[model samples]
Target chain A: MIKAENLYFRYTEGEAETPFALNGVNLEIKEGEFVVIIGHNGSGKSTLSKLMNGIHTPTEGRIVIDGIDTSNEDQIWEIRKRAGMVFQNPDNQLVATIVEEDVAFGPENLGLPSEEIRHRVDEALDTVHMSAYKRKAPHHLSGGQKQRVAIAGILAMKPKCIIFDEPTAMLDPSGRKEVVQTIEHLNKNEKITVIHITHYMDEAIHADRVLVMDRGKIVMEGTPKQVFSKVDELRALGLDVPQVTLVSHKLKTMGYAVSDENLTVDELVAELCRLS
Target chain B: MSIIIKALTHIYDKGTPNETVALDHIDLEIASGEFVGLIGHTGSGKSTLIQQMNGLLKPTAGDIIVNNLEITKGLELPKKQRKKYAAERKKQLIEVRKKVGLVFQYPEYQLFEETVEKDIAFGPQNLGLVESHVKQRVMDAMALVGMDYETYKDKSPFELSGGQKRRVAIAGVLAMKPDVLILDEPTAGLDPQGRDEILGQLKTLHDQEQLTVIIVSHSMEDMAKIANRLIVMNQGKVVLDGTPKDVFKEIETLEAIGLAVPQISYLIRALNEKGFALPDDIITVQGAIDAIQNVLEKRAK
Candidate 1:
């Protein structure tokens, strides 16, 4: 559903030494897949997410979302409609004071019929399990609830794909769990494509594919099991392995015959029990 | 040097429709040099409780004695002499503030100085230290936060990276040389490496300087690794208080309260449920590995 070809992007005006935030990068995501991109700060993860949603046009290469070139100015809104984005801060992205009103803003901007907009708003909130908070003010909701409202706004547009740029970075642990589970549900039950960009190792564990970015390039890409197996490499890149993976790696280093293939806590424990 | 609270209660906008009972009939004490971690969901009253310790929020009822000063309720001066007593109260409040430095969440947003040196020196200067002493304190605080004074002294805080700006903000607090330090969500926007670096520095400060450190975080892993005591708050109440092991053992209760146990603790709990002989309170990766290794060794024997 998403493809990038030789994507070279830079922020520059005059007399700037460095221009390219992303340099000669190529990536592709299939439809109905959940993909997570992980990287350290300033590694072009956010820039790449923006490129996916037509927020930034590449200076050199081309980005095609469902065969629509992002450089086409006329189709930018269409691209955004198809590839919606949820940002880091819930407070900043939400535009309306009320919960249901905020969720309706996206579809309303698309000039949908009033009845259709209302239906979409209600459906989106139900999908996010936030129907009960529909009448509440956005300011009175918790961080997780607000983020879910943001997602509902995006979902109201009926986007085929949603790109989250560190959605849980600003939330508490419970809030993070709520947001992550919501995204997973959208991908599983709604058949919506998910592209999650984050620095959190645990959040990426359940993704169908994990893409590790470093220095504006795709350094590694594979299933969670495949990527997390390289414990030393991830640590060297300043990325943390999952807590379970870290424990498994330490056991292996300590001359224990533990398997390194487990990605979740349950799998790790099961493997240890079998070994015993 | 111990901080004590007895039946403390705080209500925001009291006597109004928008009143919020933030802290309710609370009681807590932290002995000198103890490291305490406070955890809760948003609006769980953790912030309100910490703000009270620094005398930023006055309790509606009950008593607070910090370093032997009665901070709760009004002072015991005569009504006619109350104005003079209020002046003295302000001075004492400043003294309490100096002894209890609070690095608010997103402390980077609080930085207002043009250069890092002046920013870190802001606290000490306010404490009326000599010019040379302020400069020394600024440098020492910078070092304590793992920032090089020579390299960052003249740089604008705005020009620094997110992590660097956060460190400079924290150095400003450390420059005050507070006996107790409370940080709320210090690692909110930081990447994993930056989070680890900040937590490591706080742990070192807690150990080497023997500073009474209170960290408010939602990350169970962070609390497990550093905190000697865990304080769990839910709905304006102190629901749980104990060592990390004791508190984390009630994983179901925490989960029900909209919190999560550390991943290691979750794993160990799962193992115990599966009829393994694992202990119930594993909170760290190293501890989990050691426990699994011991089990394996016993099986081999």
Candidate 2:
């Protein structure tokens, strides 16, 4: 569970004279939900994710993760332990070269017992379906495998929520699919709340909820269908609707009696069939 | 302008312990003015193959004939004869490089000039153009890529937006006025608008300039939209080479090679399997819509 009350954040000096990165943002994410945040560069989406994970303290308002106020420095480590963060580049976040050692790094830093750390590493790797690569070097694996290993490292901490900040931005399409599918599995099977920040509209299609941000605020928030239906608005904000949505929109504009509500190919086909 | 390869094999570090075969004994021909989409997973030797076409990398064995010039054979000649052949080859290479421009992945990393004008002029200037001719080519390239030359010419390339920066990087390659432009993942890190803008500019260039375009990407939707032919590579071998419709029809083989069909094609295949009258070769969204219209008309009849 995550709650934000008028979250205002600014990456600036002492006074509020400078501009805020996130301005007057209010959001609530339920436990065991998969929420995708999308926006163009500098739309405060990445800043929102950082605030959710306690990476940055809010400037003007409050953020509470599972009843733990992020403002309290004493509870920062505990909050971070509960909400793990995975960055864009897996190579940057991985602390050790060996896969198993890298997975154990998080638990070791958490000051868990040695036996508990070993157990956590094994369980985490197994959860990510990376147990077979435990003995290999992180550099030797594919981009998707490396990212999965990074997720396993985070899962070793046994976090309740995971915030992925453009996790697949550096990966190829296959690698992107691997990371997306792996996150979907984790959210479904483990019931771990997922906050995925991405620029890709396709990657956000299956999320339980979608949040579109722009100019330091949450401009739109709804289910994928609800949010994606505002194709013109998203395009005006420099974001893109899915290709199928664009085609359907074009057809509708040409007076083809096509449904604007269609997001996927199957829906588009069914709608076209009905029209005919 | 066509390129022909005969039994081309490239082995990295021959006779060494870490020797690996990057390219097999392959034979292929690329006709002039063909828009080919090269799709492969990373490390599938696609990059290696492209580099060899431009003489950026010499093959360990076999030969490459570009526009009837035997490039690989000239490397094996004796010193004096090689010097004469090298001089002739240099002329041929310059002509080839002028006709074939390569924009590597992360081409923005190659931008290192103080001003956009000078940066874009680098390619044409290297082609031994006069100052005025180079300036004209720079402006032409800038306009071709949808950049306002008047506004961007004096500014630092570092200050432009990401899309503009990518365009400037592309204009640098375009200034050479290449007949064949090879781009590797040109839309890799761009946002949707940026990606569309770049793709649109490339498409316009392909149409107006009649430039032969080779785009190496893994996005099936992108290939489906623009490419006339798709060349699928898996583990240093050409697994499939055909039109987008033809290549996507073999969904099972594509999946087996760790490549995904475009979402529209996948849906069409699924519908066809579920006893719908949809066509199997629907690769694009528009194509799928057309197929569905035909099926619906058939159902109505």
lDDT per residue, candidate 1, A3-49, as tens digits?
A: 99999988774687465789888988999999999988777899999
Candidate 1 regions exceeding 4 Å error are: B73-85
Output the lDDT of residue B150, model 2.
Answer: 88
Per-model chain A TM? 0.97, 0.96
Best-matching candidate per lDDT: 1
Q: Which residue pairs collide, candidate 1? A: none
Best by TM-score: 1
DockQ, computed on Cα atoms, for candidate 2: 0.41
* RMSD of model 1 against the true structure: 2.0
Tell me, what's the RMSD of every candidate? 2.0, 3.4
Write down the lDDT of every candidate, Cα atoms only.
0.90, 0.86
**Per-residue lDDT over B1-301 for candidate 2, one digit per residue giving the tens place of the 0 to 100 score:** 7888887888888999968788887687888888899998877788898998888888877788888877776665666776767677777777777778899987887899999999999877877889999999999999999988888899999877677888899999999888889998898777777888898988998888888899998778889999999988887778899999899888888888778888887677656765676768778777866766567568778
